[model samples]
Target: MDTIDREEVDEVCALAEAGQQDYDARFELSRMLLEPIEDEASDSKMIACCKGCDHCCHLRIEAYEFELDSIHAYYLRELNSEQQAKIKEAIVERYPIVKDLGDQEQRSINVRCPFLIDSQCSIYPVRPMSCAGYNSCDDSLCKRSNDDPNDTSFGIPQDQNIGYMKMRQMALVQMALDLSFEEEREIISGMHRRLFG
Candidate 1:
């Protein structure tokens, strides 16, 4: 948590430098990989369905070191002093326990993300790829999330949007790379390193 470990930050940067950064070559990687999603995001279906719904925003999410680093780097350069301080305060205040917990505990944040502000994400542009990618369907997961906005339980995955789930595996890789965690903790850090860092 000490500012997104420089090592982790370097991994993604190295990837980018080597030109092997997951989807860095394609600026529209998220939009393309999750293609068809671009239109779906704005289409009446998802737009109308998700209006006034902060289900995904409230759910606990996790981030991979690379993805987290990607976000952190973006924020390091993009945000103003006031904005950075505000997000830092929010992150530290929201995850007070993580702040105190040893590296072990910090690895897995089992609380609502500190990055979430006013129930709406404050950092939308520099948000992690995961954030830009996550989309809830009319599936059981969506139903459960809508029913309990505060629920932290894992939801059922959609048949079509499996890519989102796959990308999430990188989070595990990241955590494993940084902390040799034994238990599967409950914190979620879905992207937005800018707001949540």
Candidate 2:
């Protein structure tokens, strides 16, 4: 993984702390920071992820509260009432199956994310930073991992720079939200609470 630049992180954090940027701006900043890195990685022709690949969506996803809030807002603003209802129903049904699962079980199971519709992410534009940061260089390896839970090889190739930059951007967001890392929660449960409660 690439080393995080302390100066870059500090600058973002300072802007966040100054109360100059809202959630949208913060997320946009994250996108701006990641764009060049993703472009460089893509030029290598090693990125295997594509629009119809939802294998990774089955994995457990954790995100900060602010990230979840951003998704929720997007769902409410961009989707119609029927679409919202369907996703909420899916979350309600899936939550019980996943709510009590241990971390390992959650990771091993293939529960589709509530936002996944017809094998595509319905909230792609506002996907969490964790999702934004994830990349794979081998679609076959990803399929193997997703197809068989016992396949614990985790041998998928990834761009370390993308992951490291995402971590730093997340730190900047945390500082902006005045939240600790511990505030992060499982995505399904977070959405369940947001939609139902």
Instruction: Please report the candidate that would top lDDT against the real structure.
Output: 2
Per-residue lDDT over 1-197 for candidate 2, one digit per residue giving the tens place of the 0 to 100 score:
44446675676565444323355664564455556455655655668888899889888888776568767877877778877888999998899999998778987777888888888888776677778778898988888988997787678799777777677666665554566656778999999998889
- Tell me how candidate 1 scores on lDDT: 0.46
RMSD to the hidden true structure, all candidates: 9.4, 3.5
Candidate 2 deviant stretches above 4 angstroms: 1-44, 178-181
TM-score winner: 2
> What lDDT would each prediction earn against the true structure?
0.46, 0.74
- TM-scores of all candidate predictions against the true structure: 0.49, 0.80
Instruction: Give the lDDT of residue 25 in candidate 2.
Output: 62
